[model samples]
Target: MTEISKISLRNLQKRFGEKVVLNGVDLDIAPGDSMVVIGSSGTGKSVMLKCILGLLRPDGGTIQLDGNDIGTLRQRERNALLRHVGMLFQGGALFDSLPVWENVSFGLLGAGGISRRDAKDHAIETLAKVELDAPTADLYPAELSGGMQKRVGLARAIAASPDIIFFDEPTTGLDPITADVINNLILERVQELGATTLTITHDMASVGKIASRVAMLHDGKIIWSGNASDIDRSDNPYLNQFIHGEAIGPMRPDVSTTMPKETY
Candidate 1:
């Protein structure tokens, strides 16, 4: 039997006044799969992600979750649908005022509508999933190392047992070893939940570690996609320049526009 897509986007279009960010983009993610989107900066990766998350309404096209049209949903319906989805922001995006458990349990408290007692229990359990001890939950975000902060974010993303997870630059701003730890933890947790995931990142290490399949976004569209192992075999100039980090590629990124060197 042909597997139906868990999430699908068709001819997606988004623009900011004179500048077009996503132009006629199309993609599909299968159930329990990890698909990482790789691109240079300003290539509309974030725009596409926002469109799907309903943070930014697309100027055109359709988003489908479980074959249902997302664009046509009511506010209440949207909220219900979104409860199945979770996100890890580029920054840890934790609340400094809140303790670690409260931050991890935010979505659980809101949409899951569980009591504080229950939410805290779940938060403690989820933190353990990310290899954080229970006492760590009582501490605040500011007290954690960058790697610990990221683990907390991952814990939050999986707190509600979401069927879909979004990872935005999952490995950014970390030492090589710490980044690898996060990547492994992400893979483990997502597999345990049997959730589908989409990650947008410039980090080649992340792409290799977390992606089952890879897609390249260039000039506001997905220019290429294939198995992660097949990335080096691609003849596409954009894909080649990006993966190899060659400065003199067809994209011709100038000094100010050059891609960030992979820190990890």
Candidate 2:
């Protein structure tokens, strides 16, 4: 039997003036499934994510969560919908002004049933799940190393045990070893929570580690997708070019404006 989708996007369309970013995109994410969307930079992967998260209103298309179109939700309803979602942004977008514990428990603290003391304790527990030390919780984001910052972000993302989690380039600037560690933590935490996850990244190592299913977004639409194991063997030219990091491929990146002029 086919599984019902927890999140669905159909014929999603978005544009900025004359430039179209996401054109008729479509995707479905099953409950508890870790789906990673992969593509080169400037391919609308981030824009598509923003559309699903309601950070940006789409020009056209339907975004459904648990079978209800999110676009139709009133402000109050939308706020309720957001309560079930968590996001770990690229660059570990932690508030520098807040202490580590406060950052981790930001969502819980804002909801208001729990006392600050209890929130701190809960934050520490969540930090431990991400392999972060108790002492680290006292330090500010600026005091911690890059890897530690990512861990803190992960702790925040899972603090409320959200039903749906979104990871934006979870390993953007980390070294290989550190990136691998983050990937393992992501897998462990998501499995423990049984949460559905959507991640956008070009890091193939991360894709191999955390994704159960992989989809390729190209020309503002999903051109291909399949089981994670099939990624290496897929014969699609775009897939091969991206996974192999080949310069000579069907994808012609626009370097005309960005490339530096030659100098003697």
Query: Cα RMSD for candidate 2?
Result: 4.7
Each model's TM-score? 0.93, 0.94
Predicted candidate 1 versus true structure: per-residue lDDT over 75-187, tens digit per residue? 99988888888899889899999999999999878875589999999999999999999999999999999999999999988988999999999999999999999999999
Using TM-score as the measure, the top candidate is 2
Poorest 10 consecutive residues by lDDT, candidate 2:
255-264
- State residue 138's C-alpha deviation in candidate 2, in Å: 1.9
lDDT (CA) per prediction: 0.89, 0.91
Number of the predicted model whose lDDT against the real structure is largest: 2
- Model 1 lDDT-worst window of ten: 255-264
Cα lDDT tens digits, model 2, 1-264, are 123999899999988766788899889999988999999888888888888888889999999987779999998888778878889999899999999999999999887899999999999999999998888888999999999999999999999999999999999999999999999999999999999999999999999999999999998999999999999889999999999999999998865433221122
lDDT of 1: 0.89
- The C-alpha RMSD in Å for every predicted model, in order, reads 4.2, 4.7
**lDDT of model 1, residue 185:** 95
